[model samples]
Target: MPGRALPVGLCPDMCPAAERDLRERERRLHRLELAPGCPGDPPRADPQRAVKEYSRPAAGKPRPPPSQLRPPPVLLATVRYLAGEVAESAGASPAEVVGFVADRLRAVRMDLALQAAGDAEATVVLEAALATLLAVVARLGPDDVRGPVDPVLLQTQVQESFGSLRRCYARGAGTRPRQAAFQGLFLLYNLGSVQALREVLQLPASLRACPALRTALAIDAAFREGNAARFFRLLRTLPYLQSCAVQGHVGLARRAALARLARALSTPKGQPLPLGFVVHLLALDGPQEARGLCQAHGLPVDEEGRVVFLRGRYAEEGRPPASACRVLVGSKLQGRTLEEVVMAEEEDEGVQAPRTMQEGDAPSPRVPGLAQTI
Candidate 1:
């Protein structure tokens, strides 16, 4: 009896093993409604737990385990279901499948730059998280989608969030339905990949049907390619970006750049502004007649609306045929009057006190008969 070991099951496993079992069982079981007496297994974080970990295989990394590729088909099937659900409920809950894909994707490698490791990691994690959304959306097509992944806050931790990306289901309990699709579109727009954009465009006609964001994306693409008319056309079509107040600065910037070019193109400039030459840059091939002129500092327009150039003057008679002084709007004269405009100096006069703010320098509030709104 002294030489023999206690029976395996009869022996005490000791403190360490017992403690581990105690810790592992700390989770609470999920309660079920339909099953009555049945208790669901406790939620175990394990791999699903968000962790700040990621790796890219050396120069040529080996493939991920078979489990990595498991999400595509399954998530794709869920998207197929969502296509019909939107008509009834806007979007169904198979969205859960997208979470399934997103949670695991955080483990995948991405082609991120090492120098900006933290920022890049943040971007990739969000991307992987959002990529799952695409699989579910792929079934609906791009037309039906409308909305952004994140709401515009006066201040947010980041323009888009990395945290929302780590968990596939932050949208689960109180998640908004159209949010995933809207976010997917925003991410796609910023990707800068024309081919990828085309892929996004291939989504269901329903998802693709939304012109609001699509119009904005089109404007962005046109601007990136430097196609002014296309950019203006898209802006005119949607009209939402004006209030987006989110990208207003960016919109104003592009408008300024294009306005300068339009001025040069319509005028008899002694020389052409170099950057303005690539009018067809964005693959937008339209004739000179197809172009329209907008006032300076004025929001761009396709119609003769209440828009006024910041100079607070009336819009010119439809981009004055073709002229020389039109090299750019003679905006330098906006707040000045002919009588007040400083002309030639009678050099013979010592009467010029150190030109202080004279009556001539005072700004006039309105320039009489201007038809435009500031």
Candidate 2:
């Protein structure tokens, strides 16, 4: 009698449980790949590494108690929902739907941030949800979907949400080059984080060659060099996704340019700038629009169609300057614990703490331990 030769993966000396699990996963994936109408998951260089990268929690944050964290399940649900939407949205416009999905993703992201410095587990979940969102957004054409809200406001939201994700998840995942690059550019243009964009460019050469990355880098250079004309030109030629992604920040950028123009052309009291000059500087449609913008911001226009930007005037009027008032709302208190709300209410009411019984105080309880001590 002779011992039989074991198959390579089935040997008892190797990991039997792991080999079985691997086989099971491969079986499922193979079924998925062969299934009709199943848009299977994207090709990964190493699927197991992908799983580990996402599942392993980043150190430095306390692992949140399982009961307190919803990101894993919530993001899983969101990914499934968005994947379905992406598959079914063949005839409909994707912009609004994508925006809706982005909103949900952002909400989950904010919730994760508030609870703790999220671990890698949460980031992995969020990244999966974001991947689905990116997929939906990628399917959109230039005019296929219009912005769901004011473009400027949406840019602000995307900046915060996407930037946070890039920081938490993108830094660790080496497999998501294209998605990471796009998100990095999104954060750079909307939030103007040069450091973030640079880091993305410093990624593997394969990713740096992305057209979106190149365009974003050019825009950054133009902006940094004070080449407003070039900046605007590059902005005009942004890809469909980049154009939509940067739309929200365009108004902010224009306003900033207007402020710079005002500062450059400032003169002593009573000096005025021609309304046409103001219009051109602000890139407004006409003198009337420029006049309206000036009036709204306390930059008064004279009867002769000349405008004056009074420096330090907002301080004199006991109000914050316009730039200071562009507040970004981070989150609402709707999800806060009832105890937090009660404590806040108590503080507002100036309630004092109930006095505790001191050692000298009377103890009249019928409890065995306290009565015996007394």
For every model shown, the clashing-pair count is 18, 4
lDDT of each: 0.30, 0.45
Residue 323 C-alpha lDDT in model 2:
23
lDDT of 1 by residue, 86-185 (tens): 2123233333322332222333222121212233233333443333333332222122222222213211312223334423323344333343334334
- Which has the greatest lDDT? 2
Q: Each candidate's root-mean-square deviation in Å?
A: 24.5, 24.9
Query: In candidate 2, what residue range of length 10 has the lowest lDDT sum?
Result: 324-333
Residue ranges of candidate 2 with Cα displaced over 4 Å: 1-184, 268-288, 302-374
Question: Candidate 2 clash total?
Answer: 4
lDDT of 1: 0.30
What TM-score number comes out for model 1?
0.25
Best by TM-score: 2
